[model samples]
Target: MEYGQPQASTGGSVVRAILSLLPDWVEWTVLSLIAAWLVSLGAVQVWRRIQYCRAVRAGRPIHAAAQYGQGRGADCLGSYAPPRRPDADGD
Candidate 1:
């Protein structure tokens, strides 16, 4: 009736015996490969999310205050200034 001892059942005894015979290196390698794959997937998902945010922010309208046709001359009407560069210095 020890807490850590295997139960007296056929399947449990088989599982316990197999676990005792497994090599430590085999277990470690399997666990490491699984962990590496999960980390790589997470990095790819984060990169995709960043790209999506950039695309959405790029497509947003520039200004609410300025008239659609304000700056350009009579023939050149209805165009706003080009989208500002995110990385620009205030020049």
Candidate 2:
């Protein structure tokens, strides 16, 4: 009966209500699955970094974008090629 004010609950509340109806084990299982998935993704990234470093150290030609090295300024293990200027190649 209040004007310019919504009275119905949002979808988030409905989702929470449904989730509350689930068993504790179900919540734990979902949380564990999410954690495992995130950890696996991180592992894959670490592996890729290792391969990239090895390639750089071995003097192999890497087909990476010029901007890729700038973002990896410090966190990079050994070293990477510095990012090129946008107009350096006259692109």
Candidate 3:
């Protein structure tokens, strides 16, 4: 409140000073997690593109993928099979 004096402590400055105590790895961990998420997203896009190309070549109709897949899918049909029901389930 004095004409020429400045306040020694304020809430924002105190919070900023406290933030400097965090270790370097905390920042790297956050960055690493973000980078990992982005990399995985890019990988999924590339995979979908390859599968779409295959579908076009095979003439299965891309609309089948969109309609049945709700516009999204990752079915490697040739490499996997659906589960077969056991005879006991019929009893």
Candidate 4:
């Protein structure tokens, strides 16, 4: 019975006791890992789209973006390979 000071509660606060089992730092670490995974997933999708568009414009096979000339042949406008001519021998 102290003046101006609150007496300790006789009844147990069960909810608080349970929450103290795990530290706050562990929760924050898990949240950060999940956020990073989602960001990387979005970035990978964007990169694939850019490669697909380049392949279509260059007239290279759509399925293989890497086959398109990695050299200077491609520009803003496409530089498709010249159409093949029929061989003179007709082989």
Report lDDT per candidate. 0.70, 0.75, 0.69, 0.65
Better of 2 and 3 by TM-score: 2
The better-scoring model by lDDT among 3 and 4 is 3
Tens digits of per-residue lDDT, candidate 1, 15-91, equal: 66775677988767766998999999999999978877877799954443456544323324435556547895433
- Using all chains and alpha carbons, the TM-scores for the candidates as numbered come to 0.42, 0.49, 0.47, 0.45
- Rank ordering of all candidates by TM-score, starting from the highest: 2, 3, 4, 1
Q: Write the per-residue lDDT of candidate 4 for residues 1-91, one digit (tens) a residue.
A: 6799876554545544544665778656766888999999999999999988998999978754344344333333455655435662222
Return model 2's CA RMSD, one decimal: 12.8
Give the best candidate by lDDT.
Answer: 2
Task: Write out the backbone clash pairs for model 1.
Answer: none
lDDT-sorted candidate list, best first: 2, 1, 3, 4
3 against 4, candidate with superior TM-score: 3
For model 1 the TM-score comes to: 0.42
lDDT of 1 at 43: 100
For residues 1-91, write the lDDT of model 2, one tens digit per residue: 9899866678868867777888999977887998999999999999999999998999986656545335544335445656557776422
Error of 3 at 47 (Å): 0.4
lDDT of 3 at 23: 72
Taking the candidates one at a time, how many backbone clashes does each contain? 0, 0, 0, 0
Which 10 consecutive residues of model 3 have the lowest summed lDDT? 68-77
| Model 1 spans with C-alpha error above 4 angstroms | 1-21, 60-91
Worst 10 residues of 2 by lDDT: 66-75
